[model samples]
Target: MDHKKVMIFLLSSMLFISSSGSITAGESSEKIKAKLENIDYGDITLKDSAKVKPSFNLQEVSSNETKQNFYDERIPKVNLESGAVISQKNKQIEIPFTQPLDSTDEALYSHDLVIKQLGLANTPTLIPVMEYTTRVEGNQIIITFLVDYTDEYSVQVKDPYFIRSNGNLATPSDVYITTKNAPVNVDSPKVSLESGTVIPQINKEIEIPFTQPLDSTNEALYAHDLVIKQLGLTNTPTLIPMMDYTTRVEGNKIIVTFLVNYTDVFSVQVKDPHFIRSNGNLASPSEVYITTSNTPVTIESPKVSLESGTRITQSNKEIEIPFKQPLDSTDEALYAHDLVIKQLGLINTPTLIPMVEYTTRVEGNKIIVTFLVDYTDEYAVQVRDALFIRSNGIPAIQSEFYTTTKNDQLIVD
Candidate 1:
């Protein structure tokens, strides 16, 4: 063999030994020899021998992950004081723990811890808590959000799997906080009646406006006090009573319809704080007095006669007269005195009819008349000359009325 060949073989052997030695040294550097305690919310202090690695990256970790999935597993859960958490944009939040967190390894727990403000019913608010850095500081972890705080808050940890240096995983849990400093009347509900609406008309509507939108599903409208009374009458204070009136909400206004019996000078009283707003707030109480006159509504009185194109015949003893409009049947007194038979045509000589028994009724838009009289020839009947009032209290003009006659056999021989 040649000297050059021997030298080349020696160089190759040395290179192999150096490469193998370096590979063995790399393994020792990567091996961990440090110990760690439980991971908690706090600052971290790294030691030369720290070995526990976090499951996620701290820089890219978000505090929002713990909002919905946080669970506490302790036998007796720990919580912050009631209403102790105040919302602040740049303020530091100090969360104290029962025990100290392991700072020997910063990577044992995730940095995705977050603080959130709890709303009504312990639900989270919509405002986002800005990203924050975590460190094991004594027995507490300090947090800071990017936005100002408007409510109480709680703490949550994402990737709560707390791994210790001994390869043991800690139970996952969350911390809740409350605040005592809050606005006294941040969400109070308010309402007011429409202006220039002190007097509501009979069967007319009035509206009440609210400062905020009301709860559409709330049944507060059903709980109301409706009373009506004449200003100077000696009658008892009457409750308009349920079912007499109606109330409903349209948008932010409450519509109230009055169902009154009379137009006498009366006062309508409604109790205040009668409803609840959508924000779980109560509606303030209010009273409104409605003043109206004793004026009665009037309608036209109908003329009495046979139906149009109808004629009185021997077999047609019934007289049906239609009115110009639909009559208000609610007025019983008007129907009783509005009609009277004055004259009866007997033997074709129109003679005064006295002491005649008759029956009067209403059907649809017409008043029906019937009488017991003997007819021996073509005849006619006349209504009395008087002003008859309609069912709605409107008086009909004084006019003479005559029934139509058709030459035929007598209605009753």
Candidate 2:
């Protein structure tokens, strides 16, 4: 603390005491009245008032506590009307206040207002109002805005102290409201079929997506007014008389299923309009055409002919006759009559060789015939369709034993 000499005309003349023209935080002038109380008038030197005329003046002052109490009473407490439904097709809402507000546009903005859009089961979404405006009249505040989407709304006011017409501050407020539906719903339902859509197999599903919730369930839509062109034969699609296909509703989509055929194609549309939105709006009509995949071809039995990288060599003692499929049995008795070993006869005709030393066994798809013959001997082997049956019971195509085989130049490749 800096100590200095204070010249007072009298000991009781505290009103004339010199101040530094300021007070510290949380300080009051009344607290300093006792600082001069202990001093006696006899010890202080008196100055001649006539000779020392004061060259300065003091400003009027009052206690801070008294001023604070008076100011608090003048601050107007504000109240806003609740449950006010928004009016007018135009995008604007009127807020009714309890007292008249300041005429300036800045006073309206002093209360930081926030608008939020509410939905049935969705979280609150903020509506940014950078271009919003407000006009005050009488005791009501008309808040004009461009926010136009949302089934309901939540209006909020922050601690932005607004000033009243009498220079008193208006307290902050909060409000909740439900507004009329938007003039036009941009989220109108839309639906379409996937292009080039086809059911690849039976018991498969084709999902059709919708932009918004459907008005009714799948059963109601199908039974009331729904046109579905069921798949028919190739180039002869027949729209079934009855609704044999199954359908279910999942979220914002419809799942459809049927006894799928390879030639099934679908043409679905809504004519009487049963697929409607929640807001009573008709779902936009879309021509959906779906085609099925081509019918798969049936395969015949594999030929028992020479394949690439494989050829009949007369030198090996065991002649491997492949059936191009797994053989059902490996017992030599099963193929005894069906197998015929032949060689070139005298007139170049096929002559059957004796089967005394020949042994036959099944190895995978090939029939291994073991014999005690020289490599130079041209032996022919035949697998008939009679006993040489496939594992699936399909008989092998008939194979002729001409030379040592059907033909010397037989190559499946």
Candidate 3:
């Protein structure tokens, strides 16, 4: 009887545990099915009876459902200090702040900055900080942002201006920085070379054109500020002997003249910011091409002739020669080396006339050569090869010839 009772009690305990498990599982399954009904499983459609199979495990259905967007509220936020504004000068604006930025701030090249014309309907210009630099002085960080524009501006800085040490995006204080109005007349000086200028190989001079007249006192500083270079040459060109080159200002132009030793294609460039205009604007350096050839352009061979008479006038010590081009008048020393005077018709040896002093002046195509002869000779005189004419410092070409022959005679009286 005791064995029978023990078996019946064990059977009763097992029946109660099985029923409790079934009730809990049924409740869990009902909850899971209710949650799945609200979820749109993409393209698949199902009804209440098809909610779940009777033998399906509730854990499998709960594990397979996907969560599309889950937000975690633990991300760090941006921090923008107060009192940040902008200052203006011409087209450039400066962002000023009372509190120094972090040493590792990305403000230099940050793309989150926006500048806009406040009054206009124009779209805000997204100006990435293209040019900027940062320096640390004591506990402060100094940064300069270089921005250019044509009108007034209002600056805007978005969130996450910099990344914090804790991996949080820190933004500058949200503020509208209104810049002052830009100046209208303050423009950079402009320079250009006149076209159709024929550069000579020997004596080269050009008048540089300017948008504004240069300061007279500062014009003298540009005597050496202009640099001359040969274009196609591999090596530096040998500049002609450095004479007293004249640099002067006439109206809105600067005239520069220098001696060139060799002839080839050349270029002229302004050296630095030393060139200044009357309006206090510095001249922007520029380069211009100058084509050069070895052939002389403005010079024609000088024509040498003698006054006709059986007896040459001895009293007239001057010999006059006419040229097809005007002579260079600025040449201070126009003497015997330029005009070689040699007497002809010598039996033993030709007697070259010693030129003591000479004067040359160009009147249109005529060059009056006034020769003050020291010694008197009765031989026929003639001029030598081409003379360097001085209207614009161009050398005149000439065919060499001694005017007087062996039979030719002259009375030096």
Candidate with best TM-score: 2
Best by lDDT: 2
Tell me the whole-model lDDT of each prediction, alpha carbons only: 0.43, 0.50, 0.45
| Candidate 1 per-residue C-alpha lDDT over 314-391 given as tens digits, one digit per residue, 9 for 90 to 100 | 344556656665544443223434455444444445443332544556676665655566453443444443223233
Q: Which order, best to worst by lDDT?
A: 2, 3, 1
| Model 3: residues with Cα > 4 Å off, grouped in runs | 1-33, 36-190, 198-206, 213-225, 229-251, 255-267, 271-413
The alpha-carbon deviation from the true structure for residue 346 of candidate 2, after best TM-score superposition, in angstroms, is 99
Q: How far in Å is the alpha carbon of 2 misplaced in model 2? A: 42
Model 2 lDDT at residue 369:
70
Candidate 2 deviant stretches above 4 angstroms: 1-78, 81-89, 107-111, 120-131, 161-165, 181-413
Q: Lowest-scoring 10 consecutive residues by lDDT in candidate 3? A: 65-74
> Total backbone clashes of model 3?
8
* Comparison by lDDT, 2 against 3, better one: 2
Candidate 2 per-residue lDDT, tens place, 354-404, comes to 356566677787777766554344655666644333333333566665344
Question: Measured by TM-score, how close is model 3 to the native structure?
Answer: 0.26
